[model samples]
Target: MDIILTSLINLIVFVLGAAIGSFLNVVIYRIPAGLSLLYPPSRCPHCLTRLSPFENFPVFGWLWLRGRCKHCQAPISIRYPLVEAATGLLFLVVLWNTANPVEMIGYWALLSWLVALAFIDLDTLTLPNSLTQSGLVVGLGFQIARGWDNGLNPATVSHALMGGIIGAVLGLWLLDIIAFVGSIALGQTAMGAGDSKLAALMGAWLGWKYLLLAGFIACFLGAFVGGGAIALGWLQRRQPMPFGPFLALAAGLTALWGETILNAYFNLFFPTW
Candidate 1:
């Protein structure tokens, strides 16, 4: 009975995540175009036909429609359903890992932001300030609220605020410095302010220690994936690639397993400690 109940709850959470992901698809499409998220009801981009409720259902809707619009028969991007499915799975993983309700909420929000930012950056090579800036504020606010939930003591409150601030500064300065040095080396803009903002958001959520881990992980992923793409002739040697996706992936991993990874590193290198 307990196992059944747990399974049922997980299913419900996955469905909820899929629904939110559907909305995120809307945000990804509209935000970069400077459209109001609420004003325009979701419509087929090709035909501008407003979708029926059944047609708007998450992953099932794409399957039902056979990956094409009902009215115009225009093919829909598989990414829509893919995003929904990925979000559902991610929600399950996060749910399994986080026991506290508040922490779960924070993790969900962080992942959601990362997903949207990742896709947007991939599509446009620009990360919207609206998402990153708002995310930074939300992260700080979340930490402060978490501190309050734990206790109203000054130590807790100060620590929460200090940690968040330090994390944000660390992320911002680190990225800014990298961008500065890279620009001098390459004689072109190597990174954007948007990337810095996204890093700051990561720091605000994960704290400085985890943020450093995330940065290292992102650098490693960027090199590995970027090199693979170049070797495959999919990307040019000089082509500028978006780094937000790697950063988002690293932040997500750090949020989920930073402590484990940190301990493993110490165990491997400083076993006595």
Candidate 2:
């Protein structure tokens, strides 16, 4: 009985995520283009033809449309369906890992923000301030509110939350400066403000303790990929690569499994502490 109920809940969450993913497509396109997210409904980029209701179905719509604009037959980017599916999977994962309603919502918001930043950075090499800055302020606010809602002591919760905010901001700022100095020292732009914002959001949401884990994982993956690309001739030496995706991946993993990983590490190495 419990299994069935859980499966049903996960399915519902996936569907909701798919729906939100559809909207995120609009955000990914319009936000970077400086277009209004509202007004002027989704239309074909090539023909400017407004899509019909049936043709607008999330992932299935792209499949049914045969990856082409219905009016002009211009090929649709495969990324549309990919984004929808990815968001659905993220929602499923978050739901599976989180039991608290408040935490679930917060995790979803973080996931959505990361998805936008990842794609935007991939395409344009930029992460807009709107999502990152808003995420920092809003996410920390929720942490405090969650503490209050749980009937925690005001003074303790306030101090803890304030410390988390300060620690996270400082950690990310330090990372930004290190990356900046490294770029200057190497005579190549190795990282940018977008990556810094990504780290900031991760630190804010996951707290200072988990920030190190996220940063380490991101750096490891980034380095491995950078080396591979350099070896394969896919990238030139000193060429820039988007780091937001690695950081985002690390953030999602940390959000879901930070405690487990941290506990395992401590049990193995720092048992006495």
Residue-level lDDT tens digits of model 2 in 219-248 = 899889989999999998878888888888
Badly placed stretches (over 4 Å) of model 2 are 1-4, 271-273
- Could you tell me how far off, in angstroms, the CA of residue 144 lies in candidate 2 after the best superposition? 1.6
**CA lDDT of each candidate?**
0.93, 0.84
Q: Model 1, range 65-170, lDDT digits (tens) per residue?
A: 9999999999999999999999988999899998878788889989999999999999999999999999999999888877877897878977987798899999
- All candidates' TM-scores? 0.97, 0.93
Candidate 1 backbone clash number: 0
As a TM-score, model 2 comes out at 0.93
